[model samples]
Target: MSAAPHIPVLLRPLLTACAPVRGTWVDGTFGAGGYARGLIEAGAAKVIGIDRDPLAHRMAEEWLPGFHGTIVLREGTFSELDRIAADAGAEQVAGVVLDLGISSMQIDIAERGFSFQKDAPLDMRMSQSGESARDIVNGADEGTLADILYLYGEERASRRIARAIVAARPVDTTLALAEIVARCLPRQKPGEKHPATRTFQALRIAVNDEYGELAQGLEAAERALAPGGLLAVVSFHSVEDRMVKRFLQLRAGRMGQGSRYAPLAEAEAPAFEAVTKKAIEPDAEELASNPRARSAKLRVARRTAAPAGRVSEQEIGMPILNTSRTTGGGRPRR
Candidate 1:
């Protein structure tokens, strides 16, 4: 029954884009219930809130009741949102809203180990179970660690960072790992991001299998949404934004034709029509109010009458990692 700590990033524009919101909607991420409350207050008949993190559900206990049953909180990941919605008695949802990446609530808590600023156990599991950052840093091979940093974080000195991490085995704390990474790189210039930022981001993404989850969740959203239902996603980084953008482009038949020599294959009917041709960033006012809103981008699209169909992970530009060994704890065999 308390107010959300802060307004969700790009929520105003998301609601504006998906105006006249009605029927059952699914808040896929459901972190802190900001979007769910916004939808309910904006006119959604009901909202099925889903999250993998138990903390998110526990936090909701205080304020969810204030919605008077308008929002139904579910314990699960958005990758299985379709099943989650069905179990909640919503066969088809009118809209699906996903706020990707770690939430402010998760980052602010030192024990969560998401922030390098606060030293804590190197645990960054979103679901609070499975492999942790500690396991990855202490176990994964050098090459695999390098790939994760390069592909996920776009870090230019991934090899050097990975080498440093491997040499400094048993890195048990956030600050320890951050210091190791910072030592490998040059001192940051004024206004430059911390050296450990990319390394931490890469480790967190790997620990949570965030890219894999995003690909599956996008496909699940396609299936769960009713015809004309809207699918809106807010991504904080380029990797996530690219995946969402390409998925919409391919689904909406916006992909361009191939060159004369190499003909493009025909695609199925458009599954969705873009509501925002380009990603929508927060306005200056929002940025001033919430500095975290700076990098966030919101993209929305409306489902077509076409039947729900699956899109290949490659088609959506999903970042594929060698998850067989490196992701779990062991080195891949030659």
Candidate 2:
């Protein structure tokens, strides 16, 4: 039997890229404890699992004991992973692994509101308690809603979808909002994702502050890692992949030599070195077993003795919402 209820997106390649995993490691997005368990089984002496969702911790109670003392669960966002690990007595860790975005388990649950296919409350709160997708869909102004869809989800019909949603105020449930957004776009064709996919994804990302969390979480991992420690991330979308790529590039002192569009900056000691020169994708065999891995991308880096530093959100290609047009549901994490 598998240790995790569902296999994570890119376990094989992630493990391969982060080979010889040992010592203490932080599974920053410990959804369902899959990656945490994977790290322990991959030769880590201990794994500190961090998650924002209560559901993940609740489900972990069943199997965590089986691992004896190998897995330690901490309930919090990955953005605070470094502090959380230090509090747990691990000042620095051997590796940090993050499986970004909503887990498959969250989407499978009908009431989580992560899945547009499910007719449930529009509550895409990873922590299960906060301003939910319901609040954003119903409360955010049309322009704010449009910006979220456009910037976060890359939805070209964001304006039309936002207008339709405002016309259908109090979008009470997942399906209700999905239906409204779908009406503003072309009907789905064979093999194409549902029309509401982008809109729902946009709102969920907004509700969860996923991009901000990701940007902060990467830095946290850098700070929490000891010299030679590994940082591996699996991202499911283009925007996320781009962010990770840029962060690693900038940190590893591989920022392209003066691209005409990019501003030059003084170089400092590199904090990390790339372990995987290119992003790894699932093989055909794994894709056959888990179709969800089709879009997954894995990147790995190793920490250096150099001090960890910051990267501008712009440097990493994080989508910045126009503050003037922004309103509820997408507030930056405090």
Taking all chains together, each candidate's TM-score versus the true structure is: 0.95, 0.95
- Number of backbone collisions per candidate, in order? 2, 0
With a 3 Å backbone cut-off (N, CA, C), the pairs that clash in candidate 2 are: none
lDDT of 2 at 49: 94
Task: Report the lDDT tens digits of candidate 2 across residue range 1-334.
Answer: 1222578888978888888878999998888887888888889999999998888888889899999989999989998999999999999999999999888888888888888776999898989887888887777788989999999999999999899999889788988988887788878799999998888888888888888888999999999999999999999999999999999999998886456788765778899999998999999999999988899999999999999899888889999876455555455533
lDDT string, candidate 1, 1-334, tens digits: 2222756999999999999999999999998999999998899999999998988888889888888899999998898999999999999999999999989888888888898987899999888998899988888899989989998889999999999999989799999999999899999999999999998888888888788888889989999999999999999999999999998998898977568998887768999999998999999999999999999999999999888887777778777777675755322312
RMSD of 1: 2.8
Clashing pairs in 1: 1-62, 1-63
Q: Which candidate is the best by lDDT?
A: 1
Worst 10 residues of 2 by lDDT: 325-334
> Model 1, residue 291: what's the lDDT?
93
